[model samples]
Target: MQKINVLGALLVLGLMVQCKGDKKSVNKVESNAPITEVTESVVDTTPIIIEKPENIKVPDGMVWIPGGEFIQGAVPQDKMAMDHEKPAHKVKVDGFFMDVTEVTNAQFAKFVKETGYVTVAERAIDWEEMKTQVPEGTPKPHDSILQPGSLTFKKTKTSVPNLYDFSQWWNWTIGANWKQPNGPGSTIKGKDNEPVVQVAYEDALAYCEWAGRRLPTEAEWERAARGNKSESIYFWGDDDSILSQKANTWEGEFPVTNNKADGYEQRAKVKSYPPNDFGLYDMAGNVWEWTSDWYNTNYYNELGAVNGPVVNPQGASTPYNPNMPYAKEKVMRGGSFLCNASYCASYRISSRMASSLDSSLEHLGFRTVATVDMLTAN
Candidate 1:
């Protein structure tokens, strides 16, 4: 109920205070090969060959992205460009399959029912683990504050809090999860088709594993979101003045008011808006999706230019948030219903966001990708 303090030393501790969240790492798999010393003549020359993985049939309710070269990142001098989206670079991605829409509530429910999986929000907080995150002597938050729950967006009236203070509108409500998106006493009974909200990165990964898929990388997501128009600022076209039901972004004052011009104040059913050129739906708004790559504010600068595009470029190997060095955050794309031109205009295709891996909020969710191996059935 109180506005979250942006300058607090325990800011990372309040990461779940949002319609958005972030992490400090993406947990890359590391291979440790044993070192073996060989005699001068022990090594014989042998041909080493690598084979391209075979592509498999596209899954149901998904679309194929016939990958090719595309300009990645925001164009130079973009009016809405953020510092992180600068130094647009060329990236080449291989063809892959992407979900036609975000994972729906019904779809997630099926996964939970079949696998008996529990989301991060459904689990109780570990004070022991959390204690290490705070200053040594910081008092433990109340038991009720530590109860199992997710962050939910609560509308504000009259004046808005400091623009940077997200806790003004984002409440860490106990008992909020995928099943009950708005916290206790809320339900998704009649909203089977709506994109599932309040899912953390791990929960999304679990569903991806059960569905035999994986989360898309940052490049893959940006490539898909851009569709056929590489130069357009938005997924629909160049014009940012008119949204026109193409996405489900906030229509009026952000956090405080929504005109509902898009016909929904909060989340809308997947496919309720128009699909991008690749037959993909909701690439711009509705929910900020998770990506596999780690985030770095200066990642684009790291990718120096080359004659050819950087092939299938994954993001930075390790997450580096100068703000929260300890929290593991991943790349988030496509903004959410809370985005508004008057305030948060993160709906731009090139706009970037990061969130803690454990964040589960009402405006955050994800879709999956079918890698060549997963699609090929191994």
Candidate 2:
């Protein structure tokens, strides 16, 4: 009976955008602030840092994350910790090169140009392939609803009365691809430096293949996002109040009002906020980055029983969410701009989120990592 996909369920955190209801309308931003310049490109177009250590070559736009042992989950007393992020367990990760920032429009543009990759959002939906994902007997979506497009957040005309009913804000916009993030009229020009959104897991993987990189495993992402620290509620520190302009999260009321106190209504340019100790930008906000891990709510609990740190822990072999056990979902790290304390506070360093691999949205993007083997192979 639901018109929206699982994306609508995952995004219904507090006052965050929800599925579009009968009240269809778009709220416009009235701000007249000048668009800020894009930050320096993460890709080092010049060949310079070749004299580094054997294990840490520091790829052009990437940084050397000297991986080591660290706690991978959340501890009790961290009131905000979710069930999936509990039972803090020790994990050991190998060193690798990580993109310093989320893959920007310019970077993905090059990949598209080189390989002519058609993103999942650009391809028409296949009902035969999709019906298997839903419970048997669920009605098939109308042919018109199967068009190529992606989910997008539209501000509510009024304050959201029910956070659980997200249909007031989330809309499956037709023609909403990465090239046109907002909808048919939106374009990526002038925002070339911003993180590319509306990317499904396959789209991100295609870009990785073209660039000779791979998506980071969930362990590597958490370890790197923590900046090699032992424990902290957030990437920056334990403090929750420090998430204002430091990260591009919602600063005002939920779907109704976005104060744009951080100088952004939607996604912001990479490096708009200060990097963590690891020198990684946008680790906390801007857009949710995809990870190469299957989603399993019980995965952490399984690791907790281990006697020692789980070395280079790959996620569960199969995806499983009790709420939607049949759906093929992948782990997503780092919260997006839509995250706010008023609704969803997933910006916590230890928080976790997952979405169907086929789902794409305006608030989602990804970065890639390269291991020693991958780098040498290239």
Candidate 3:
């Protein structure tokens, strides 16, 4: 069955990345250097002390993630883990500072007010790039339809014919930028602390640049997500019963009804739930956050083969998905409000999702991290 690919850019051309325009700027950097192998050293069984380097003031609202070796992908207890998150491997990342929560609308608004910046969803479609994602000779869309828009989730009243038909629940909402999350008439006036949504990868990059931060590599993100408890399916451990009380996620039937059993029908304010072991809120839910890694299903298969632990590993050089072979996809970690066991049970710590680099959706947002060297250099 042919599906309309409005939310996601359709049939991308030859994985041809680095498209032009503000709505579609991507830097697909590759590291040709060999993977640095972790070597055995004298074990310091003493509890590692967490302290910021002298003279380095910690960024406001960020916390230090003490770096250490941890399993990077799926742990054996994660029954919900998918193929992309499999073949759990050990990895070591350097200490870095991470935002305490998913970036909030108020925080993003501050960036916009200071820089007068416009997000990608607030810009009109670039047909030249759009055409590349669509089939050859596909007629250009009407000018009226080319206005700026993003995918906004509109819950279905009844069960969808099938879960694959995403159009059953998502609307192509013009004017649905981060400010108007549910499109026009839906303002963020009173919801400043909710996560800013409808932001594309480029939009997040712009924010990161303004903040003197960058999206964390997928490895770093996982490390933070695991926090001090690195071996469990969740930061809390293997039990799923307490999930509803611990995180903001879909608590009832998906795409139809949300029980709001967690007292939140949608995204709760930042810090609405308890923080993880690392003091990071919304690590398992609230929203799916953008990471610097390119999406590749077999990435773990490659990493799991390496000897010892992979040290401060960067992501795959290019995006790959046998299903959507051409879309320039990036990794989105953590689940969102709409994730559930009935469908997208990605709330597991090791869960992952992927989206086209050029696509923006209401449930998609990002947080950023800064390394010590980055702060000293800047």
Q: Write the per-residue lDDT of candidate 3 for residues 1-378, one digit (tens) a residue.
A: 111223433322122222333211121212342232322211224433245687888899999998788888778766666666778887877789999999999999999999998777776677777766655786876777677777788888887656655556777777788888888998899999899888888889989999999999988999899987778887778888999877889988788899898888877898988888889999988889999988866566667777777777777765766445446778999888888887767778888778877778888899999998899897
Alpha-carbon local distance difference test for all models:
0.75, 0.76, 0.77
What lDDT does candidate 1 reach at residue 368?
90
Clashes of each: 12, 7, 1
Best by TM-score: 3
Global fold similarity of model 1 (TM-score): 0.85
Q: What is the lDDT of candidate 2?
A: 0.76
Global Cα RMSD, each model: 7.8, 11.0, 7.4
Of candidates 3 and 1, the better by lDDT? 3
- Per-residue lDDT, model 3, residue 375, is 93
> lDDT of model 3 at residue 54?
75
Which sections of candidate 1 miss by over 4 Å?
Answer: 1-55, 305-307
lDDT tens digits by residue: candidate 1, 1-378? 111211121433554333233221222111331111112211223321122334355679988887777888886546767657767877767777899999999999999999998888887677777665555676777776667777788888866745656667777677888999988999999999999998888889999889988999999999889988888888888777668568899987777778899899889999999898999998988999999987775566655434446677667766766555556679999999999875657888898888877777898899998866565666
Candidate 1 clashes: the total is 12
